[model samples]
Target: MLQALTILSLLFLTDFTMAASEDPAELGAGLQNPGYEELPAWFKTSFLDLTEDVAEAAAEDKRVLLYFYQDGCPYCAKLLRDNFTDREIVELTRQGFDVIAINLWGDREVTGLDGKTTTEKKLATLLGVQFTPTLLFLDEAGKVVLRLNGYLPPHRFAAALRYVAERHERTGERFSEFYVRTNPREAEGDLHQEAGFLAPPLRLGDNRRKSPRPLVVMLEQPVCRECDELHQDVLRREAVALSLAAFDAAIVDVFSREPLQTPDGRETTGRDWAAELGIEYTPSLVFYDTQGREVFRTEGYLKAFHVQGALDYVATGAYRWQPSFQRYLSARREALAERGIQIDIMR
Candidate 1:
């Protein structure tokens, strides 16, 4: 009985040891010990005193490279271990940036410009920090020059840092222009292909003297996968493109920093206006009259044919008589087919 009990205890111990070894968080924490001598000289393993360091760096006209991370953040650990330790990234960052790492959920006290000391968690909350591994390039005055969220591989991270640094050196050019020039991949028709279809110039806004025609306003978020897919697949199709061009079309970024005036005459930020419109997801299409009054709204992804049918229903005001939008679209397509107008309604 004693021999059998000893064998079972050994098996339990072996299983526990193997489980701990395989856990990424546990392995990362073990490797991140403060006394670990393997860290490169350029990389500081210590927590940064952001209050003093950031202020000093800003006063010197040096860009502040602020990395916000949290304990048990797998992406943050990877960024620190791989990206921050890359030879090229370390060298470039040393030249132009004062790098600092702050714990997102840490209890460390940080002194503000107003001389008030606040915890790191409070500061993160105040700054709207939601994701781990957030990188911020800040100007001397503490204004954000560029903000990047999530994990990036070493090469991409280095390139992004260099792009921000070059933009900072340019005195006359705006960050947007500099970014496009420095990182052509982020320019229109490249990494940001969807930006091309967001033709705001075609929309009726306060700048217009007269309403050109009825409009369809598409409220979208930049990072929304559904929005990207819709733009790439359905909106880019030839039939849908031709159909959409018939009306005054506009695309509004819900997360834009600019202020927008709603149809109800309430002035709010673009983000707030989108929330007020009850848009909880991407690819929300809202049809409006020439006066910007909401006529109908559709949320979620739609295929090219369905989008075309919806546009027809809204354009002809057939939605009033139809019991449902989907039913209206079906009847509209059949009616158009009977009139010998061939429309591709597949996929």
Candidate 2:
């Protein structure tokens, strides 16, 4: 449906930088690799100011992976659907890089390595990204040390993670030279939009003004498969879906600079608000009560049951008394079980 679209967030101790094409139809045409808005939860919430991003990542003892792709690229789809879905690969990348997605064909403003503002398409050209799913691994100084021209299978992708994570380049181990020789896993999941999610052109200001329930702000990117899974596999399920209905949901871009009224009655851009809150990861769930005060927040990947519990915690006002979320969840499960309701944490 989106004929005109551009670039996309969940960050780990997460942050993101972007102006994106947020349309699923255009994100990958038939491929299903959406933009950064659907990206997984581990990516750091960043300003897209590469210099600041590099400094922040280094402060956190993390490196950076500047991922370049465009709409309708099959290899890009494979990278998200296959490589990133691998648990080991996800965890390995999580332990190492703060991944940022950049659209090779987008026109969104990007703050370049030289502290100059440019569009995504221009920057991609500057980086010489001739293919979809090009990955530029940057060191602490924001300098590219390794560049993978196109998609690498899961095994090689795993090796890439290790190569960068362990500083293998310092040992003179080339990526192609040290490639992990093993069978690759096939990709999984149908790339579809998260149904029942708060639809886009998110009018978050209106949400705060109209709803009396707590606010649930989902900081996401289009390329986030985990975010996709949360909707496709988890949030759309019966119980969790109902649980989420209690809040006024709004999906926000981590990299957006557009100003809006926040839940706490402050006027700020999403990027500035995210920075102010020190958001570290993608697909985060930040909750606010009727008074616009933040009551609770979940900053990274969480299973269905926990996500539901987090929602319930705020909805039921459990956070007011039970400071320990773990304790509250334990008591919740016990109470549910006593009533003959069994909770499936994963499903």
Candidate 2 structure quality by residue, lDDT tens digits, 221-284: 4445556666667787687788888888877765567766787666778777776876655567
Give me the runs in candidate 2 sitting further than 4 Å from their true place. 1-159, 163-206, 340-342
List, residue by residue over 10-52, the lDDT tens digit for candidate 1. Answer: 9986765454223233456546422121223543343445556
The TM-score that candidate 1 achieves is: 0.43
lDDT of 2: 0.74
Worst 10 residues of 2 by lDDT: 6-15
Point out the worst 10-residue segment of candidate 1 by lDDT: 184-193
